[model samples]
Target: MRYVHLYFTCIKRSMISRLEYKKDTVVALFSFFFSNLCSLAAVYFILQAIPALAGYTLAEVGFFYGFSMLPISLDHLFSDEFWLVAYRRVKDGDMDMHFLRPVPVIFQIFAETFQPEGFGEMILGVALIAVCAGQLTVSLTVGALVVLCVGAVFGAVIITSLKVAIAALAFIFKRSGPLLQIIYNFSNYAKYPLAIYPFFIRTLLIFVLPFGLFISLPVDTLLTGAHDPWLLSLAIIGAAAVFFALALWIWTRCERRYESTGS
Candidate 1:
């Protein structure tokens, strides 16, 4: 427990150090916030003219955008390393130091480059949530809040694991960024309500890819009482398990591909 706290403390300190050293940190952070706001604004403006996106209300669409973004933003903040894991580790051979570390290579990578600028997006998400709370009427029950928290954490884990698994494949293939980017693009579909999608489309998002569960569907359930909360929780746990196993398997298989210069 102490180590866990220290780990996060280190991450916070690292972020503070970077912000202090880089004069443009604040600018970068605000830029991120405005960029996200711009995206949300475009959605809001489009929805203002249109009655509904499929079956989702304007407020619900707002909630969906905010909620879906929460997971991706958090993932970007922490797992940014995964996106560069292959390119940096392999091409530059910088992974040598990681193998010498006491902690896991992945943890070390994540800890080394913790970007808190993502906090800006997170704050925007919170503000969006507040707006959605006001716009969309729902019973703010203790049970529902607990469910949402669980779902969010699970969503983060699943997204992280998906990234890890995909990045781990870079061990076998040097240039994996384009492939990862494509996967990220596909995951963006969850930024809106999946309910309006056809049966096959919904099934593909919910089961095959599972990004739809991250925000749209779960938050939709919270807003409209459309689906079982327990199902979201279960899906998060299940997806995390499956993806984690796959990542571990790939990492182990590719460990042999690792060649350190220190030897």
Candidate 2:
């Protein structure tokens, strides 16, 4: 409870810092909105040409894309600071301040940024899901809805755990941005139906990076009844717990190796 309060207090401070530059915040909001808009437009244009992707209809594809954004946007909202840590902070000794805090360094990093830009993605994603869901014929089940909710919330935890684990590598290597970028780019593949990909790529997305596990699988269950929703929800929750625990372990181990650049 104390940690929860501290987390919100830190988030409030971060929000105040960002809100001080109101114009910049607005610009950031629009930039993320339009960026997502452009991506959706591209998907629309491609569907116009191909009509369907891997037996998935246009509305179904849009639903997949929209649902995919939920986990990514949530991760972007809460863990944007990890990007800086992965790319530059450890190398530049910017992490020294975090280490000096009485709290855990990982907690400090998590609280360092509260990106309002992600709200743009969240709004657009929810709007797209609503619009596309209305066009689809599939009936959503109670179990399916529960799985989707679990996928969205716990999926964010999975992505954030991956980021935390990757960023911790910087403590040892001094920069893990390129590797993190490469791994994160895999999430883009999850934006479409996994059936569109080859067997190996599909396996990698589900078992290795596991982006498709949470994003594509839940949507597939809803649209095609591909998996047992109750089991899938359990799998997602278990995966999230395992990934988060492993990430914390990795971060704690790697953190001990950090040495200031003394720059």
Give the winner by TM-score.
2
Instruction: Please report how far candidate 1 places residue 21 from its true position, in Å.
Output: 4.7
Give candidate 2's error at residue 20 in angstroms: 3.4
Q: lDDT per residue, candidate 1, 66-131, as tens digits?
A: 777677777778887777775566555667777886777766667766777667677778788889
lDDT of 2 by residue, 200-224 (tens): 9999998889999999999999999
Alpha carbon lDDT at 43, candidate 1: 88
Give the runs in model 1 whose Cα sits over 4 Å from its true position.
1-13, 16-21, 141-143, 259-263
Q: Best by lDDT, which number?
A: 2
| Residue pair clashes in candidate 1 | none
